[model samples]
Target: MAQNLMVCQFCETSNETKYKCANCDLILCEGCKIKIHTKIKKTEVHQVLDLKEFSNLSASETIRHLDLKDIQCSIHNAEHCIIYCEDCKLLLCAVCLLESHRTHNLTKIDEMYHRKVKELQELDSKLCEELPFYADLEKELKQIKSESEIKEIITKQRENIITELDRLWVPREEEISRQLKDTAEYCDALKRNKAQNEETFQSHNATAIFTASGKLDKDLPTRPANTISKQKILFSETRIPEDTKEVFGSVLTDPKCKITGSFTLNTEDSIYKIKTFENNTNILSLTKKSTIKSFELKHSKCNTTSI
Candidate 1:
C-alpha cells in the first residue's frame, strides 16, 4: 500500500508532518521539530501547534486589537476621551466632554494632531534656518563694542593733548586783561564827569554853571586795549615742539589699542592746501619737510607768464 508522506521543514528529510510552527507557518517532522525547537535560541520562542489544531484565522479576527481608548480620562472617572476641545485645549471623553467642554469649540483628536503638528514643525524649521543670521548679527555687535571702547580711549587722550595746547593762550589773555584795566576805569570816570557837568549846567547859579560847562574836557585813549594780534589768537603760526611721529606713536593713541581719526595728517609737510575761493583749493607752499626744496618750476606757456 502507498502511504502519504511530507517533507520536514528544517532538515529537508521525508517524514510524516507531525506539527506546524505558528510564527513561521512551517510543517516539520517529529525529529526535526524537536531539534529546531530546542537546539537554537532563535527558534525556541516559536509556537508549535498540532497539525489538526492549526488553521487560518477567520475574517472577523483579521483586525488587530489596539486598545485605542484614551486612558487619561480615567482620572476624571470619564470613559474613553477621544475628542479634543479647541477652545479649552483639553482631551475629553464622552461623559466629561459633554458635561464640561460641550459649549467650547471642538475638533476631533485626529484632525488636531495633523494640523497642529504640521504647523509647529514648519515654524521650527524656519527658526532653524534663520539662526545663523542672528548669530552673525550678535558677533558683529560685539566687534563694534570692542572697536568703540578703543576709540573712546583715544578720544580721552586727544582731549588731554588739547588741554595742554590751551595753556599757551592763558598768559596772552592775562596780559591783555591787565593792559585794559586802567583804560576801562578811566572811561567809567569820564562818564561820571559828563553827568556832573550836565547837572552843573542846569543849576540855579548861572555863572558857576557856565564856568563848569567850559571846563568839560574830552580825551581819547592813547592805544586800543583790544589790540591782540590775530596770529596770537589763532595760534596758526606757532610751531609745536612735538613732531608728527610722536603724535602718531603716543599723542593720539591710548595704551590698550591705537585709533585714528578721519583725514588725520600722519606725516610732516612744509606745504598745506588752502581753500581760497569756491571750487578752488590752492597749494600755499610747495616744499616737503624732509627735502626743503620747491617743485622744479614748470616752463611758462605764454611769453609774459611766470611759474
Candidate 2:
C-alpha cells in the first residue's frame, strides 16, 4: 500500500508523486513539487526522500538469513569449505578428501589461523624477556667507556709529571758534576802550594850550608831532604750525604741507586764480580765484564754479598 500510492509530504499531491529524495525524506510531485513549489516563498530549502517497500518479505523470513551460509565453493554447488589443499591450490570438502587430496598436503584454514595467533603470542613473550638483557648490556658498555676515559686522563697526568721532572733533571746533574770537578781541582792546587814552600826552605838551607863552610866552622852542618809524597784524595764512599744516606737507606738502597765496589780475583781465580741493582740492573749486568755466564737475582735474601 505504501508503494502503490505516492504522496508528497510538502505538496500533498496524492498519486502524482514520482521523484523522491532519500536523504531528507521529502516526496515530490511533477506539477506542484517542482514547477509550483520551487516558486513558493518559504519552501526553497526543502529536499526530497524516495521510499521502496517489498511485500514478499516477512519478519521471520528476514531473520532466517542469519542461519544461511552466504559464501559457497564454485566447484561444489552446495558444500562449504573448511580446508585448503596447498598441492592443488583449491578448496575441498570433507567427503572429497579421498578423491582429490589423498596424495596431497591438506591444511585446515581454521587450524592455520589459530597457529598464527599462537605464534604471535610467543613472539611477544620472547621480546619482553630480551628487553632487560639488552638494556643491561648497553649499560655495561657505557660503564666500560667511562672507565676507559678515566684511565686516559690518568695517563695524560702521569706524562705531564714526567715531562716536568725531565726538565729539572738535566741542569741539576750538571751542577753536581761541576762541584765534583771543583773539589778535585782544589786538592791539586793545595799540593802544588806545599811543594813550592818546601822548595823555598830547601834553597835557604843550602845557602846557610855554603856560608858556614866558607867561614871554616869545624862542625859540618847536615841538611834534611824534604820528602813529601802526593796524597790521593779519596771520594766519599757514600754518594749521598751521610745523614741523608742513613735516613733514606731503605728507599735508596732499594738496589737501584747503590754503587758497590768492584772485586777482582787473582790470575788463578780470574773472576770479576758485579752487584745486582733494580733500575737498569739487568741491562748493566748483561753488558758487564764478569766471568759468570748468566745471573739470576734473588731479592729479600739474607746472606753476605757473594761473587
Candidate 3:
C-alpha cells in the first residue's frame, strides 16, 4: 500500500518509491533519484532522505523548510517579499516597507499567512451560521411585495367600476337636462305675455287698451302638464356582501353595512336637511318650509310621520 501511495515525481511513471527529496518536495524511485534528479542543475544541494526518515518529521518542521525568498514583490518587481504588514494586509519588500509601511505592525510572511488562513476559516463558519436568517428575511420581503401587487390590482378594478357607472348614467343625465330646458323655455314664454299685458293696461288710448286686452286673453298660455313625475329617474346604490372575494378580492375584514330605500314627504317645499339613524332604518328630514317628517323603513315599505 505504501509503494502504491508513493509515485516517482520526476518520471511520473514509477509507482514504486523508496526515497524522498525534501527540498524539491518529490518522491523518487532509485533509477530517477540518481539518473534524472541528480542531473538537474543546483539540485545537488537538495536534501534527499529515506522514506522512513521523511515520515518521522512533523508538519511544522516541513513548513519551516519552505523557502519564501523567491516570492517577488508586486510593487518592486526585482525585490523579494520579506515581511507582511498587518495594518495594510499586504506583503512588502524592503523598499515597500521603507516607503509606506514604516509605522505599521509587521510580522514574518509565513506567520501572517497562517493567521489570515485562520481568520478566513472563522469568517466562513460565521457566514454559514447566518445564512438561514437571511433566507427567511428574503421570503418575508417577497410576501409583502406580492400583497402590494394584489392591492394595486384591486384599486384598478375599483376605478373600472366607477368608469362603467358613469358610462351607464349618460342617457339618464341627458334626459333630465332636456326636461329642465323645456321647463325654462315655458316660464320665459309666460313672462313675455305678462310684460305685453302690463304695457297695454298703462296705455292712454281706450281703443288700444280694449283691443290689447281681448287679444292677450285669447292668446294666454296654459300651464304645461307635470310630465316629469311620470318620467322620474332614480338611482339606487349596490350593497357590498359580507364576503367580497368573488367581486373584488380577499378582504381583511367584512365591509361596513349599507341600507337602500326611498321615501316621499307630503311637503311641496324642497328638503333642506336629512339625517339617518339606527343603521339607516329611521330617517328624519326637514323641508324649506320648516316642516319636519320622520320615516321608518320596514318590509320594503316606508312609514311616514309628521313632526
Quote the RMSD, in angstroms, for model 3.
Answer: 39.7
Please state every model's RMSD to the true fold in angstroms.
40.5, 49.2, 39.7
Write model 3 residue lDDT over 7-38, tens digit each, in one string: 78888889778887766767899999999999
Prediction 1 TM-score vs. true: 0.30
Which candidate achieves the best TM-score against the true structure? 3
lDDT (tens digit, per residue) of candidate 2 on 1-307: 3575757666675667765532233566766566766676644543432233211222212222221222245467677655657677565666566566878887765454334334433433443444444344445434433332323323343454434434533353454344434433433443443343223222212122112222322221121132111121111223347556332111111122334343332223322444555662421222334533333334532222333
Query: Which numbered prediction scores highest in lDDT against the true structure?
Result: 3
lDDT of 3: 0.55
- Overall lDDT per candidate, in order of appearance: 0.46, 0.40, 0.55
TM-score for predicted model 2 compared with the true structure: 0.23
lDDT of 1 at 298: 29
- Model 2 score (lDDT): 0.40
Query: Residue 14 of model 1: what lDDT?
Result: 57
Residue 163 in candidate 1, Cα distance off native in Å: 9.9
Which ranges of candidate 3 are over 4 A from the true structure?
Answer: 1-7, 19-25, 45-64, 110-307
Better of 1 and 3 by TM-score: 3
Model 3 misses residue 245 by how many Å? 46
